[model samples]
Target chain A: MTAALEFREIDVSFGGTFALHKVSVGVHEGGWLGVVGPNGAGKSTLLRTVAGAVRYGGSVLVDGEAIDGRSQRERARLVSYVPQRPVYPQGMAVFDYVLLGRTPYLGTLASESHEDIEDVWEALEALRLTDFAGRDVATLSGGETQRVSLARVLAQRAPIVVLDEATASLDVAAQHSVLELIDRLRAERGMTVISAIHDLTAAAQFCERIALIDDGRVVAEGTPGEVLTESLLGEVFEPSIRVIDVDGSTVIVSLRVEEDPS
Target chain B: MNAGRPSSTRLRWWWVGGAALVLAGSLVAGVMVGPIRIPPIEILGTLINKAPFVTIDTAISDRTEAILWEIRMPRVVLAVLVGSMLSAAGAGYQGVFRNPLADPYLLGAGAGAGLGATIAIAYGPATSGWFIDPLPLAAFVGAIGGVALAYLLGYTVRSGRTAVTLILAGVAVAAFLTAIQTFLQQRQSETLREVYGWILGSLNTAGWEEVELVAPYVLVCLFAIFIGRRLLDVLAVGDTEAGTLGVRPGRIRLVIVVFATLGTAAVVSVSGLIGFVGIIVPHTVRLLTSSSYRVVVPLSILLGGAFLVLADIVARVAMTPAEIPIGVVTAMIGAPFFAVILRTSKAVVS
Candidate 1:
């Protein structure tokens, strides 16, 4: 089967420094692919390239079609991205913010239709954010805000959802809940999910496959059991890393490298 | 499930209707409540008679009629036009900048116009028979030029960092232009009163000619902004998010800034640097109603019209005959009101 989303030799550079250098990756339909990387490892840049938020060389294809020449509105219909730090304007209502997801579908001169409003309501309901609809977005808690961001992307109704460390700001419990919600939604909708998650354990648990990137290159790409090993993570992370299977659950921890007795 | 959230369509009508009613009331009051007291009923009748295919005969002297038609009506209409124009532009600036305090004048338009008016007053022909006066023409060119210069400077610095660079460039440009204006004013001491008068702003000279000059630009800009309001809402989320949502923030902002600057320059050319209407009106609308550009943009147009008309009424009446410049009235009112908004509404200021 053809991959739902594919990035081919994507190269993104900012101010003479390569953020992503000739990175190629793909995720099949209904598959959750987690991208794990060290700091400044080009994960966000790769995701941003797919979201068309960054200028890059090489092609990003959706279902066997190159999207470079497609209009932004057309691309938006295929992929919805939730950035690492979502901007929820202080005065905007949660409903209005989510309703913005329908922008690609609406004409410049047209107002939101009944169906658009219904879709927003559906997304809100699915996220259990119906109660927060009228509240100012600034007033939402971090987890709630993350959920609201997800709700906005969900309302976009794109076939592929790309999240760049969406749970980075959330607490541990909230992170799992948010990922679980996304997993359940992806399963129900059969959507392709590509998320750059910082926590390896959570990524292993939620994502079907994992891509470990270091220094603008994917060093390993396989199922959690294959890609995440003690030796590989230790090499990439610099700190002494340990991966242990606790009752069939992958738990990754980084131990402080003891001062080498020089 | 959505009860707390007011139905947008129904609430929109109420907001629009209420604002429109206030604007109508303010316009009528503006025409009627002048130094020459004409009965409100008679003024209404005279207004009705002016409408196409309508006639309402009331005992009214030729002097009152002249005052109503030539003097008060034109001024009132110009106030509405300038008020609405400034508010629309202000809201657009605030949206694009994502700064609540951003106004139409934030981009050096006011300072450029001030310099232009100063140059015209200091050196240009004092009187002319030309269809369009040289002062407004010069000011229009200067305002657009100032914004263009700022944008170019911003682009040159870093094309990607426009929002911050543009604002900084605008400040630099405005300060430079203002310095030139001050030096020119000091050199031409005779034109000091005239230049200051223009800078302080007024609608006292507003006639049918001035009204005709600015209406089309105002209408065009308002129409463009009306269509782009939703995109403006998307822009409030910042560039990356807006781009991800398929709206090109740079393009949309450029379009909005162009139209807004055009409208603002047109009005400022005629009315001078009317302070605070741009800041006060849209902020007021956002406070009382919703912050959604869909609501803020249109309601700002109406409420701004009403706000300025009311302020112009105070400008005309408070000192009586001496005629305080409309800008003074707006500042006197706007400063306190804006402070109150900042203090009271954390959502807006934030």
Candidate 2:
């Protein structure tokens, strides 16, 4: 079977500085791939390039089709990305903001129809945000806002979902809820999930396969146990850590601490 | 969510319908009293008589007939056209820029129009002592040219033009043009009075020709913006998000700018640069409705027409025989009202 998303030799540079250096990876259909990397490892750039937000060299394929060649609208229909810091305009109602996810399906000259509203309502319901439908996003709590962001991507109904550190600022409870929701969606809907996660423990628990990136290159790519080894993480992150199995899933727990001298 | 009265589609229609009713009232009032106080009944009769196949017995005298049909009606129509055009463009600009303070003329239209009118006053047939003012024609061209220059400068920065860069480019262009205009005004001291009068803005010379000149452009541009108001809502989130959602922000913004500029230039050419109606009317609409452009655009048109019609009435009657410049009247009214809005609402950023 064709992989759901494939980045073959993806290279991105900014004014002679490389962001992603001939990086390549692929995920099978419906697989959840978590990207773990140190700062400046080009994890965010990889997702952004695949989302076609930035100019990139080499080929990115979504379900065996080149992503760069597709029109923006066509790509949006195939893939939806939730950015780390999405700007939500003040005074926008939750329902209205989520309805924007239906834009790819909408004509340029047309507004949201009843069917589009129905999809928005369903997405909100999935995220347990039905009660806050008419609330302005400005007044929302952090957890609610994160859930609302997820609800927007859920409303898009794209086959492949990419979360680029979208839950980094989220609290553990909110992060759990978001990851569990994505897990449920992948299981029930058979959709692909690719994420750039800072939480090694969360990535170990949630992701079936993990890709370790260091200095704009993928150092390892395999199942959580295969790739998220103590030596590999120690070498890449410079943190002494231990990987433990909590039931069937791997969990990364810090074994040592480097305290600030000050 | 302040839960400000359930901002659904039904409530939005109510706002539109309410504004339309107020606009009708203002239109009638605009026609009835202007230098000559024609009675309400006579005004109503004259309006009905002019309708197809319906000629009522002449309750209004012939002078009243000429005043109502030829003078006040055209002026009132132009007022509506200009008011609605500027306000819609203003609201559209605010949406594009994602800033409340963004006005219709923020993209060099006002300065360009003034420069154009000044050039005509200083260099055109005014030296021949002809009453045929070439200011309007020149103003229109200069307004479009100013915006074209801004667009070119903004476009060179990127294909997906960001609002901030475009706004900066516009301000730079407007400042340059204004400097030139001032120099021209100083050189032609004899024509300075008329140039100053034009800069202060007025609706004194409004007529059928002016109305005809502005109607098509304003109507077409307004229709396009109304159809694309949803994109404006998406745009408020920012361009990259808008693009990721599959709505090309640059393309939509360009379409809006083209039509809005055309309509605005037409009105500015006919009526000079009446201030505040564009900024005030749209900001008022946003306050009443949510910040959704879908609701703001149409309401801006309706309320803007009403606001300017009322402002023009004040311009004519405030001093009672000595008319003030309509722009002066708007600035006086709008400045205070804007301050009040700022004090009351937390939405105003600057």
TM-score of each model, paired residue for residue: 0.96, 0.94
lDDT of 2 by residue, B1-350 (tens): 22342323323667878999999999999998777888888888988887999987865789888998999999889899889989999888888788787887888988999999998878887534765457788999999999999999988885446888899999999999999999999999998988888888888988898888778988998887788788888897788777888877888888888888888898899888888887888877666566778878889888888888888999999998887999999889888887787678755331
RMSD of 2: 3.0
Candidate 1 local lDDT, A1-262, one digit each (tens): 7988888988888898888878888889899989998999999989998888888999998898999887788888888999989888877899898998998898867888888988999999999988788889988899999999989988899999999998998889998899999999999999999999899999878999888999998898889999888888878985478898899999999887678799
- Tens digit per residue, CA lDDT, model 1, B1-350: 55455443224677888998999999888988887788888787778888999987789888888899999999999999999999999999999988887888888898899999999889998566665579999899989988998888877895465688889999999999999989999999998999999988899899999999999999999999988888888898998998889887878888999999999999999999998898888887777777888888999999889999999999999987788988999999888987887678645543
Clashing pairs in 1: none
Predicted complex 2: CAPRI docking category:
medium
Compare the candidates by TM-score and give the number of the best one.
1
User: On a 0 to 100 scale, what is the lDDT of residue A61 in model 1?
Assistant: 89
**What range of 10 consecutive residues in model 1 chain A has the weakest lDDT sum?**
A231-240
Which DockQ value does candidate 2 get? 0.54
lDDT of 2 at B166: 94
Candidate 2 lDDT for residue A79: 85
